[model samples]
Target: MVFLSYLFVLPVTLLVAEVALLTGATTLAGVSAVITFGLGLITVPIAAVAQGYHRAPDALSPTTAVVWHLTSQLWDVGDRIALEQRRCRLRSCMQRSDQPFALPRRAVFVFTADPADAHVRGNVTRSRARYLYRLDISDTYGQVFQRGIAVAIAGNVHATVSARRTLTATDVPTP
Candidate 1:
């Protein structure tokens, strides 16, 4: 969105402004009309691009990105906790040799997105798409803890994270 906006808006805005200024429109109404026309010219293409972006298959929705980012943070914290646990275990072992500690193995997280229900129709913003996501974070010992997550994206700007009770599985569907 950032790249597209800059590419389309900046050059077009500059060109339109220059054209408006250079073209003889000295009268008040004429200047206002020119300004309006330039604004329309700038707005139309941007709106079209934005609409296209939202509908594009390659585009990543804000909600999905937020969910992924939150899950990644959880994974990082889990790794740190697992490392500390490993260190504690090593200390208990009482290895007297002057050797560097081996790093604990990292567990891979499997993220899946469930399909949205077609029959359940709701509000445009407050839709049925909002639901609890089951996130499984595995420790170094291969024990998986389920964390229930509820993600709400308002206006595609604000994301609310509500961590509820744990579940047995994990996944999120693309918007």
Candidate 2:
């Protein structure tokens, strides 16, 4: 009981002192006196009886409490703003497409309408086992002419190359 009283009473007294100091009361002898007395009554009995509160209440540190509250509120607002931006960008992209082609569900071999025409147009090349299709696309023509539709189809070709490559490297397995 003595241990409980000293632990509880001393810290409550200090907290009251600190609160009075922060609020700039003229003395510890007015309305501030009544407030701190009420706070002591509430805190002292609990600290004496509860196993958890054998010492001063460490749960209400001012700095950590303020930081956690501010961080949570800021994250909530930021996430909503990010979601709205993504929705707006998606809508804008959809509006720009002349006739948007639906993506294919499964992979399949794509053949040009005419192999001879593809070869003569210099758009198709054949090696030992595969044929490749190629096209040069820029942003203005790609969206305006619905070139994504043709590119999407050509993407299914066995070995398409759209750009020039000077050198290539890959990890080779050692026997």
Indicate which candidate wins on lDDT: 1
lDDT value for model 2: 0.28
Q: Which residue pairs collide in model 2, if any?
A: none
lDDT tens digits, residue span 8-38, model 1: 7566656665675677544644555565566
- Shift in Å, residue 67, candidate 1: 9.0
Provide TM-scores for the models: 0.21, 0.17
Q: List lDDT for all candidates, in order.
A: 0.31, 0.28
- Residue-level lDDT of model 2, residues 48-92, one tens digit each, is 343221111222223211111000112221221111212221212
lDDT of candidate 1 vs native?
A: 0.31
